[model samples]
Target: EFNEVFFDGAVAAEVVGGEGDGWSVAMGLLALERGVSTLVQQIGFAAELERVVGAYVAAGSGDPVLRERLVRQWAELRTMRWNALRTLGTTGDPGAPSVAKLLWGGWHRRLGELAVEVRGAAATAGPGHWAHGTPYELGLDEEQRLFLFTRADTIYGGSDEIQRNIIAERVLGLPKESR
Candidate 1:
């Protein structure tokens, strides 16, 4: 589902496409997400991201202060190519994705933390007011929910440990860790 964009296109006046295996597709999705994030950092916002932000600002429906804070925080997101160059000795190398993924995990986590903090709330504070003592009731507001979601960035796509290992073995040519 996620990698469809990479597979489909009109070639020579003919639509062409094919599905990729799950693992490869998932990996591509992770890389795509990181690339998009970096692009957004470089170009402010565009396409869907731009549309979302603009809609919020136009309608004045979302919290303006939070929006501004997020804009600033997003601006601080590391340049993907720069970080990749530092870690892998080159940009767009095989190891770049590993480094980018590692950075993304931390970046999203920090964005979540900062966004919630800017709103004078603790994102780490336990479930919001809801069915008290109920396991199903994990209290959280929108921003905190976002924080919780981004906290899993390290584990999703690929774990930080995995990315580190990729960098060590594939990029740095270190030996694989013993099982």
Candidate 2:
């Protein structure tokens, strides 16, 4: 189900907020959604950070690079939480949601990468045995799953580029990019 499409264009329905206003409605909702969801997401991120730290500790490998990365990740997590709290309940800024999205999207993806890296080479391999007649079986462990799934973190809700554009144009008063 890695490439599973949750929903396609099969179910057509009338727009609730009115025709031609879908973008506006969606943006308004997204602004509010981003504010609230980020706080919840920080909890999950904190747990994941602990898991990564546990892996690092259990390994007993003092690779300075990873140690520094882990510390940086912790700092970034704190920054993300503060950013979310700072922007919460504020509707005056148009790019606040995009800012939040941009902050956590990259951070989560990096955490996924860190999760796999903390496990070293062993994290790359899956179950060695095949099932039935199939030569391949999908048996990704937690770290592997996290690494693979977070690849789309920046692309799903709004891509990093899109978020940057939003911040540039809406927040910074920059000119919009040409279509």
lDDT, candidate 2, residue 51?
92
Provide backbone clash counts, one per model.
2, 0
> What is the C-alpha local distance difference test score of candidate 1?
0.60
Can you tell me which runs of candidate 2 are displaced by over 4 Å? 1-19, 130-137
User: Which candidate leads the pack in TM-score?
Assistant: 2
lDDT per residue as tens, model 1, 78-123: 4554564354423346666777777656766766565455545344
Best by lDDT: 2
What is candidate 2's local distance difference test score? 0.89
Q: Report every candidate's CA lDDT.
A: 0.60, 0.89
Each model's TM-score, in the order given? 0.52, 0.86
Tens-digit lDDT track for model 2 on 74-162?
99999999989998999898999998998899999999999999999999887876645477546778788889988999998889999
- Measured with C-alpha atoms, the lDDT of residue 158 in candidate 2 is 82
